[model samples]
Target chain A: MYFENFASLVDMGGHGIYVWPTYALGLLVILYNIVSPMMARKKIVTQIRRQAKAANNRKKPASSDTGRKVNSHEQFSANGQQQASTTESSRTVNEGE
Target chain B: MNWTFFHKLGSPKWFYEISGKWLPWLAILAALMMATGLTWGLLFTPPDYLQGNSYRIIFLHVPTAFLASAIYVSMAIAGAVTLIWRIKLADMALKCMAPIGTSFCFLALLTGAIWGKPTWGTWWVWDARLTSMLILLFLYFGVIALRGAIRSATTQARACAILTLVGVVNIPIIKFSVQWWNTLHQGSTLKLTEKPSMAPEMLWPLLISIAAFYLFFTVVLIIRLRTEILDRERRTKWVRNAVEAGARS
Candidate 1:
């Protein structure tokens, strides 16, 4: 029987060099087809999460209105946290600008 | 039968909800069938008297070849439905089928090559059947590439629909290539019209394997269609709810 040993399957009646590679390639293609969409889904989910965080941050301003408009950088840090302790504090500072 | 349900079929949300109910059953049945088929094919079936152990590759090759063609035909139908009826789910199904069809085509080619080396004394040949199958692979790549290159989903779907219709012409070419030209590729072993040429021991597993492949194709297609639906409907309330629930978990 062909199942006599691992070597027999590998040898495949002297067709090993061709047969084994074909099986290997077929298995690889199947594995990749199953795995790729999963990876793409992960990538998309990460992008959507980042977009939602940005949209939420955009809705709330960092400081109050002033005689002169306050720049976003002056009101909040690059990381999107408020630099001004309170809107009142920033309003006083903004009048000078 | 309720004809009004035809209108409901056009709705993405309805299909998504319905598909969710159907997917689990399809998956479970597919797994069961595939397991039974492969087990019967790999173990219990006796070797061929003429070709011996190498004939075993037939179990893998023929079924995948069958699927490779069937998927393309199904895709063309979905493409037609999407173009004429404007059913978004049909468009999604056509898109999802591309990768699955490509995978099956690849398997058919690979297994055929393996079988050829043992039976035909070479791993590769430019025989009519093989050449036409290679063209089918290229046609699949063309469809995928054209879809990816287009920026708008609707436009892309339309373009793919047209391309799929054009590719349908190639399917017959592949089928008849063996007959049209004398080639190294052997004629089909199993035929619907003729009595099966193989012994019962070999024929049974081969039949089981084909059924298994059909089930496996359905399972993968449903999973892919679900993913496509969710992605397309991300802005909808149901999708948003699903996303939030998923995020929480």
Candidate 2:
């Protein structure tokens, strides 16, 4: 705004070479800071989901073997709740004991 | 003193939930302030009498330098909390701060070098202030490397904390290097106890930029800390539920 025209603003009174690159680099650094963590977050969520899915898959067959074929869906839900509780207890025990 | 707040911070899940609520506001404020400051500093602010328009780099240089040192001090404080309280959240914070701090340190060095070419007529120098700052960057690397080398989380946290505390001794050296010894790098323009040498137009945008950088650091730190919390607590029920819900959505 201080400059009279667009050319002067870009020229920065002949210091544009130094000034512009510095600002450009600064912008790059700021963008990196924002983008890096979001990428990491995406990777972490995907990993956690995969692990959760695998754990559910591993428990599904065991629950089916113990319950009747007709009630497999209900048995699976009950087994999931039971598995979650057991894992919670085991985690506490591992931490405390 | 009400110590409940301090105790609550010890819980990673609580911190994660609270930081999630705060992140959007902080990120928005940072973006707005930075955009305002950059526009004002780059175009509206007048040129320096001695250095001319190239002095505009100060807007980026000063904020990055401030963040470089400030982030290290914070990492040290978080390190102390981890050491004393054995708070996993504090360790998580300390771990997350390193890479962010390192990037800021790199920026400060890079900007200073670029500014130096126009002002001091050289891109690099081995003077006291510059050397101390370079050492600070190395110290950041040391902490990060130490963490990576150790496989045990408990051991890694303890070692990184000690290294951070040790590296903090360099901070005061960096602060005093310009005054204590001859250096091409200039002394502080903005001071806490006295008036800054800069004019109001230049100073105002610099102040805004500093605030914006701090807010940006906080937003990023919180985001990193949340990811760390989820990673460390993945085996817990809350994390399992959260991840499952996230996947469903």
Candidate 3:
């Protein structure tokens, strides 16, 4: 070790305040770079899943009149949810592109 | 030059598949190098004759400063390729690099200020080197903002490419700033044409740190680029299959 002991290493000969904070900030930036993209990846995956589900729903329609009404209502709500989430994801993905 | 490789470079799907294999290797190498370099720089290297322990900041500062300028030049080159060839993948690279470059620029500024506090007796000065670096940060912000503001991809790419090329002028200015004018910031210690002024013990760890930082940048950029490819090509069959496979896993 360059220093004699732990305390002195942390003290860094009275330059600890400046040196430590710089390293801390550097760590923060590095962590942020890793994290922000991972979050973006999650957002994109969610969007793709939502779209695939919607496409599957469209391909198979309900048969009975009662079933159609219930299915229509559920589909309406799902579409609303997908629209809200798609807008959010598209904004992030657009910034990334 | 085989045109097949040049043409293949334009394919986002091919790049995505290839980069996925490279990612883990790059990440492991980057992490190992950075861990070794930081440990050596912070714990093993001897103190400077004048700056004492505070000089340790150079390990982080120099690498980030090098990245900040290097990434800009790369972004500009990507921009040039995009403008000339109209390659979507190149534009994606150009766009994705902006935020990473911005973060590094911010790091350079922050670390420079921190190092200055003890060494220069002040946090900041409106000197040539400092001001030009700040401008580099703004250039990154402008590219990112312009990308967000423009809706059409082609227009956004064209405009950003023009801006990126124009901003290339500042890089040479930043490189020569300390020499051209009187400045508080010191001149370059490491040079391409000659040996570094620093001792081998200090220089070796610094060289390792610089290499590690570049590898780290590649890892992050590739990750971001992969995400860009997926998002842009979301409607394609391969993307759907990939997403379904991901869902299954």
Candidate 4:
């Protein structure tokens, strides 16, 4: 569909030297735009899944290596969540008037 | 306060979700316009009486050239949005738009050169239009390079936003350079306030081709923006839900 005949498309009114390369480069760049992002999204999903798997593995009682290193950011988030629940509990106790 | 709309706009997941619905329609319109444009330009239009069929390259050249300038304007506007509103989506839009702009600029230069050879008997000249258009390409490259060079997303966004704003001054100069100087490249074929210089038979296809390229640019930008949103929001809860849902189906 791209070219009627390889020779004709290339020859392009005898402007092949310029014409063909322009189209070729355009197609290549467009393909890169389409392909690169999908690849990056796939990589991100894989990394997240890997981390989730690690977290799940750590939760298992049989996994004796429970001391597996946790990411600092993840640890911080967990701590923040606990602190939030503790504050809620304190508020509930105060409200038990 | 229209908080629901505001919140939805802020949420990358919402954008990714909504854009998913919109992409197909954009793609279809872009494809249809492009196909019609290409067909009309390549086949329906009469060959140039002077330059012969080599002039057909105008279909590709003009659209890409227009987009080259248009993309910069869009990117600069996106940069402004990020700077004023601190919208992460705008920053991502700017980032996603860079390579697309660069490619369009490259095509414009390449096609212009090709159109040049058959018509002007040279591959390139240091015409003002040509030189500034080249500069536009370099500016796009610089933005893309700056994004990769910086490690922090916020810093990268700030730096690139400023750089894009600074480069915007070149766009008008590029557009007017032909008329201001006795450039080898001719003046604009189409303009807003004046009648088209070309015959309707030729003008019709040229118009369609321009529309097609515009649509194509939209299709590509939306795709790139969606990808950028996903990458930036990867660690967010909504992203996790979106990805897991995608993985499942």
Candidate 5:
């Protein structure tokens, strides 16, 4: 609003080149900060969900949490696809909601 | 003074659930404040008589620089907590904050170089302020690389804590660099004990941007911390349930 016209706003009396790029870079940094973590969360959830599915397919799916079998989660996750007789490798890696 | 919060603070699950609730609000506030500050600084604020429009870079440059230093200090405090109390959450914080801190430090240095060109007629100078800031960037890198290099989780945590504590010495040097030795970088515009040497309109946006950047950092740090907590605590049943029940945090 300080500028008289749009041209002057962009031109900034000849400093636009510097000002604009700095802002564009700022925008990129902000987006990266948001996107990176979201992706990580998605990946983690998908892996866990797959492990749960594998455990269910293999046996009576450890019906409980705290009193559940130790190393069950890791046992399924590490060899989830390898032991999966039905070829879980191609199973949709769904990140549960 | 009630001290029960310290124990709660050390609980990763408590932090994960709590931060999840706060993330949305903080993200919205940070976005709003950042947009307001940048727009005001870019358009509404008058051009400086001396530096012309190039001074506007200060909007991002100064805020990122402030955060780079503040994040390092926060990392050091987290490091100290990890060392003294052996808090797993503090160690997680120290680990998660490294990437965010490094990004901001890189931004600050890049923006500073850009701002330097038009005003100082050079991209960089081997002065105290610039050199010290560069060292701070390297310190961030050192901690991050050290974390990746060590295979054992406990050893990695301790090594990073000691490194962060040692590198904390550079923060004060960065603070006093502009004054201790005459440097190309200008002295601080906003000071605690002195009136800001800036026009009211310009100062307002800069201050708002500083607050926005801090909020933005917290928003990002919490998200990162939550991911870290999930990764480390995956074996626990609570983490398993939380990951399955919750959507992308």
Candidate 6:
């Protein structure tokens, strides 16, 4: 609104180079702040589920995958929550909140 | 007054649940405020006569610099709580706040440097304010590094807390550095005791932007804290129930 046109807005009377980059960097930092935590949460949630599943499997004496086999089996099932659909869980799996 | 509030705050489960309820609202408010303030400051407000268009960088620089110092002061308080009361939450807060604080501090320094090139005709100087701010950044790094050095969790918490409190001494020096010695940096634009030097149009957006940054920080902090609670309390019944139920849903 202050500037006469798009070119003037971008040019900003010759200070646009300095002004724009600072804001771009600010936006990058803000995006990082919001994103990194979500990524960490996903990693931790998946890890906890995998560990819980492995513990449950061990409690079953009749289970074929025992001792060394269980560890390898768990390693195979990285998407360990197979029964839980990915899309739904990804949306709602943040600690039932 | 009852101290039940304090005890409740100390409980991670209570904190996790309460924070979850507040997160969405805080996030929405932060988003709305940020959009309004930034757009107004960027387009509608008149440019400064002396500084021209470059003065717009103040919208980004000032809020982050404010957050940088405020977060450090907060960490020091959290450290003190950890030391005196031995509260686990306090220590966890100390741990979590470091990265966020560091990011904002880094942004402040970077933006300051960029603003400086045009304003001061140099990238940096050995001036008191700049040097003290640089020290604050290192202090943040020191707290984070000290955590990784110790193997024992308790020891790690205590060491980081002590480091944070010790580094708090830099805060006052940073505040007074402008007055204490001649510095290239100008005086504060806004002050609590006195009226702001800026015009109403510019000042309004800057104030809103500052509020937006604080809210945004809170939203991110709660998100990190909740995940931390889940990680630390994985063995507990509440966390297990929540995670399993969440997965089922």
Q: Which candidate gets the maximum DockQ versus the true structure? A: 2
Question: lDDT of candidate 1?
Answer: 0.71
CA RMSD of each candidate after superposition: 10.7, 6.0, 6.1, 7.0, 7.2, 7.1
Over the stretch B125-166, how does candidate 1's per-residue lDDT look in tens digits? 998899888888988899999988886666787899999988
Q: Model 6 off-target regions past 4 Å?
A: A62-97, B247-249
DockQ (Cα-based) per candidate?
Answer: 0.08, 0.31, 0.29, 0.17, 0.24, 0.25
Candidate 5 lDDT, B80-191, residue by residue in tens: 9888777778888998899898989999999889888989999999999999999999999999999888866667878999999999999999999999998888888889
Quote model 1's iRMS: 14.7
lDDT of 6 by residue, B1-249 (tens): 886677667888888888888888899999999888888898888999898888888888898999999999999999998877767778778888889999999999999998888878887898999999999999999999988777665677779999999999999998889888999998787887999999998999999999999998888888888887776666556766778777311
Write out the backbone clash pairs for model 3: none
Question: Is 1 or 3 the stronger prediction by lDDT?
Answer: 3
TM-score for chain B considered on its own, for each of the candidates: 0.93, 0.97, 0.97, 0.94, 0.98, 0.97
TM-scores, each model vs. reference: 0.80, 0.89, 0.89, 0.82, 0.89, 0.88
- Give candidate 5 regions above 4 Å deviation: A61-97, B1-3
Off-target runs (Cα >4 Å) in candidate 2 are A63-97, B1-4, B247-249
Candidate with better DockQ, 1 vs 5? 5
Better candidate by DockQ, 5 or 6: 6
lDDT of 6 by residue, A1-97 (tens): 7998999999999889888999999999999999998887887778778777876777677756445654554354432322222122111122222
TM-score of chain A of each: 0.58, 0.64, 0.62, 0.56, 0.62, 0.62
- Candidate 4 CAPRI assessment class: incorrect
Q: Give one digit per residue, the lDDT tens place, for model 1 in A1-97.
A: 3367788767756656654566566557656765776665565455445544554576578754443234532332222322332132101121122
Q: Regarding DockQ, does 4 or 5 come out ahead?
A: 5
Q: Residues A1-97, candidate 4: write the lDDT tens digits.
A: 3346767655766766665566666667657756776676566667666655665666776755533433432453311221222112111111112
